[model samples]
Target: MELARWTLETDPAWNEPRIAAQIKLLILDALGVAIAARDAESSVRVGELIDELGGNPRCTVIGRKDKTSLLSAILMNGTQVRALDFNDVQYFIKEGKLSVAGHCSDNMPVVLACAEYLGAPGSRTMEAIAMAYEMFGRLRTLMPFVSPWDGTSVSGLIAAAIYGRLAGFDLVTQANALAMGAMRCSTPSIVRWGKLSEVKNLANALIAQSAVQTAMLAGRGVTGPLEVLNDRGGLHQVFDPALDFERLWAPVSEPPFIMTSNIKPYACIGTAQAAVEAALNLHPRVKDRLGEITRIVVTMADLPMIRKQQAEIHRQYPRSREAADHSFTFLPAVAMAEGALGDHQYRDRRWEHEDIVRLIELTQMEVSEDLARRAPGAMPARIAVTLADGTVLTEECLFDSGHSFPDRGLSPDAVISKFTAITAPFIPQGRSQRIRAAVENFETTEIASLMALLQ
Candidate 1:
């Protein structure tokens, strides 16, 4: 009731010109990344699973000419968004440590599927997306879960909020649905730990998939512990013990979190973006002297929270495609040696090159305490190359260019260029233009028509 009380009280959307512009860009970015990954191994495997487990076909899956049940469609589209590890990510600062609390756009598939099913217009979808962004930002900041407990633990609840608003669930029903979704979808964080498997991309998507049914049950008079929100044996028990419901539910007067999220210029983990920039910045400089280099040093933020699994020695030496993307050593080495970072660098087992492996061997990942304090706000990385002649050429990137800060974020034109570049190979110029127009003017466009463009 309290959540609904505030939900009904605050404006669902901050529909000014800039707000509309930013939301549309973020949506376009998510959709582009998803479309690029339509043929990923994760997508194919999940498609097979969808076929084996049959449901009514009524929803569209991005980049494919097929229909699926709402849940399967969400799973397929959500997995595509994350399959390449290149989706939009929102990081949070807690006690001066930058921690990734999962992606807000992971639930975009839920909103899109819901919009198609409800035959909702793009205006209504934008409103629901704004609500989902608001709730995710607050929970991610106030009482978010990090490593050891997957961020999807928080995302599932926000997915329910979007579902509730779009489906016209009453205050109590929506709130109860949030609780039910939370109770059911706290997946283990191990999926991202150590050597990552294909399942890593499917973790949050799995939560979104299950949320479709659980949220609907609440809408259909399925009762859950409403008090589970703050009372014992619920959020307080499973998530943060000292939960601050008031702060978490407080209305956000600042810009929506979508404005601060990073759209991921590189196809690697969020933390590795700075490393890519750092490596790329020094790539041209080191191109001629790469062989003369004796060592490559990457200065990174000292992240104690997530240091256990990723910082381990074996993690630095990637053994699989998933591991290569998350590998700090592999990323910088490949970028420095190849002068680029993207899905292409990882394909064909290019990281296995003896020269790249030699670079990885020469690479060392170091952390700076000062850098740690500035993280999540500014992801800083510095690359220092030590040549055999004792010459050092250094480059430092204070933040990834793709970050959505007002002062120096990625420009609208650049974002559009990125979308066009990545999805150009798969999508024709005409269809790409049509989708861009629809999303840019999304507040007035029809969801069904836009989805048809994607299909």
Candidate 2:
């Protein structure tokens, strides 16, 4: 309801240099992921869709030379950003409880798309990104219910706002854009459940495209329910009854929301990060004992373990790459067998490897109340390997690398390394370095140049 008013009026403390730096890192991290996934199946599929939906050329798709309509560009670029599932994630802290909001990078494509279309500078892009992150973070804290749709829906609204801002829409027009964006985009939770598909990665992209379309309509004088967020039977009533309107309308923070987010070091679901780390930690100890491993027990929080068990029938024989990547049993087993979990591990029928399948067949997941209690702050997990000699080795991962843990948070150099490695295949060494340098000095670089480097 008041989200529109707040979006128009709120003066987030973006003048701070520290916050500026964090925003830059977030954008760079997202771009790295997108560029790296240029050749991924999901990205290629979305590119084909863009071709099918031919429109006026306006924006460039990352890692591709083709330019398409604004909406098409957003869809293609957004899908690439999430194709590998290695983008950054937002961790919302409320009432001493921690909850994952969504991927902050989902908002980057919309911002970058709009900026490139308008020839806006990197500073403008950063400001738009900060706005999106602030809105997404605050909205997550306000929502009372947890649904997979929250990320895409919230991202749609933020994307609309960014598009409106770039188009020089007045407060009223921008608010209308938000209203329309919110009213139209309703993603389903099924995208993440059961046997996953390419749709899983494209959900956010669709919402973003819808947001841009709605914003374009609003900019041209179209109107929507102004109180879509809080009106009777509106978003609040339809999605979450426990919505915290007070906090949602409250003032913005000093450090900003991007600072609280975490980058993923591995290319898998966020929940599986800790488990994979735990499994990898135990990999060295059992490297020579694979033939002797009779059982591998993974204990994690109740909810995560339950979600993993939902696919018990397919854990050892995943029919799709998406399915294998999201499987708790499969991912840990892959970590143990390959010593790493990345794009390569999920390809070339690696999920069907004899050792991995054996490990998956031997693996068991159990709900640990202790681990559940430690969740939201620490995604705790324990992996125990029982060898043929009756010897058991156990290792626990409390905070995954690249997470926002006090000591484990990824440094700038580490982030750069990750970006470089992921995009190395698609982008040449010199070009990738130039892109990184531009992001490092993003405030002065124009978004057009940055987008060019990405292509």
Q: lDDT: which candidate is best?
A: 1
Question: How does residue 105 of candidate 2 score in lDDT?
Answer: 86
Where model 1 places Cα greater than 4 Å from the true spot, the runs are 7-13, 142-147, 303-310, 370-376, 406-410
- Cα distance off (Å), candidate 1, residue 232: 2.1
Question: On residues 1-455, what C-alpha lDDT tens digit does candidate 1 reach at each position?
Answer: 77755543446445656666777888998899999998888988998898898788889889878788988998999999999998887776665666775678888898999888878778778877777777787776655444356666676787777777788788888888877777766677778776678988888788877776778899899977777666776666345646566765675666566667678889888877887998998888888877898988888877755464346665688888998898888898888887988779977887788888899889887878777666547667888999998999888887777777843334687578779989998999999999999998898898888999998
| C-alpha lDDT of all candidate models, in order | 0.79, 0.77
Compute the lDDT for candidate 1.
0.79
What digit string (tens of lDDT, one per residue) describes model 2 on residues 345-396? 9778677778878988898877677776765555567888899999999988
67 in model 2: Cα distance from truth in Å?
1.7
Models, CA RMSD each: 2.2, 2.6
What TM-score, computed on C-alpha atoms, does each candidate reach?
A: 0.94, 0.92
